[model samples]
Target: MKSFGQIIKANSVGKVVDFDAGVDRLLPFDFTATNTELTAAMLDDTELFSDWINKQLANNNARYGVGGYNEHRTIYSRSAHFDTSEEPRRLHLGIDIWGPAGTPVYNFYDATVHSFANNDNFGDYGATIILKYEIAGYVFHALYGHLSLASLSGLAENKFIPAASQIGALGPKEENGGWPPHLHFQIIEDMHGLKGDYPGVCRFSEGDRYLANCPDPNVILQFDF
Candidate 1:
């Protein structure tokens, strides 16, 4: 079977946002140790992280700070949520869009609401929504996390959401699992029947398996960075 990324590339469907910027306008954000601006203190402080993201946007004159697909980030160490007995989950499996809170998020294609929930935990995806889509005769799912809690309201299973429709807004720190305001978008080739939520980060040892299931979200977001 063709990979999800390949299928999406051939279809030439819709987009996740209504932005008019090209890939050049997209800025790359670094949350790893190589980013001299980041520190242990900043990772745990929402205000600091938000300020850092703002700086990145202003410095680059970009509308969005993107990247982090398959990236090994040191920021995950701040939360025990990613820590496992054997290995830590430092590898990011999604494309994070760093932008202002309340930025509207749209669906890349027509889909049905698969599930949603307010996973109110420290360093977690507070409000999340998963959409089920079928393309090229294959069924797949998309997970939108770190969204405003209000977005989950009125959502029902199997609810039809039109392509490019406003699905939700970027959430605040308190509502979005205490992180800097951003959208965590992931493309899942298979959900394994899971709903409402899925792991957006994984351990290094499990990178191959998780990366296979969760392909590069840029295929849907279409942001070059």
Candidate 2:
């Protein structure tokens, strides 16, 4: 496996955020490790942070969403946001690459389309796509929520997304699943009862349960950025 930072690249060059122009606020490993509340097991025991950072990178062939809410919504999502409480959402499963509308997104790796649907709603993945794959002999699935209508048009079960294939594009705030325009990428070990969509938002009471089913997106996209 490769380190997350080594696999993914900055989606947009010179995109500024906070104080840096043309640069998004990248996330470092310590952001999750240093947090006392985060369970050690959830993040690979604080050493490697699960070898899947490439999942978050943006190749030139690919256009990563490039905004830390400065250009788009200016808000942020992170695992640290999830607490032990049963609040609606305790953590952010995927790294949102914020950029303008119509940016193309690529699959981090080869995958089989497990399930997809138009789960459009306020704060929901308007057009969601979930791809199943395996790593280290372990079966898993990666989901791309909040996709554009063009991305979701005419899909089927068990679709194939070749490694780095252009599968979808970033949606705008008007219909990108109710969010202010960002991608919600998540890694799941088990689908549970979820079929076309899964619970990205949880009640504070179910925080612990969701945390178990969904791990950190960094586990796949190890990029601290």
Worst 10 residues of 1 by lDDT: 15-24
- Summing lDDT over every window of 10 consecutive residues in candidate 2, give the lowest-scoring window: 67-76
lDDT of 2 by residue, 1-225 (tens): 543223223221111111232453443322332444334443433122212222333332223433121111102232333233544243444556544466677776667889888876544677888888754445677778778878877677887767766788877656675444456777677997578787665544555676566666654454444
Error of 1 at 187 (Å): 0.8
Model 2, runs deviating above 4 Å: 1-91
Candidate 1: residue pairs that collide: none
How many collisions between residues are there in candidate 1? 0
lDDT, candidate 1, 1-225, per-residue tens = 787778888996776755776444778987777987798788888898899899889998888888899999999888888885678889999999888999999888889999999988888899999999998887888899999999998999999999878999999999999988899998887788777889999988989999989888887777655
lDDT of 2 at 62: 28
Distance (Å) between predicted and true CA of 224, model 1?
2.1
lDDT of 2 at 13: 16
In model 1, state the lDDT of residue 183. 92
Computed on alpha carbons, the lDDT of every model, listed in order, comes to 0.87, 0.55
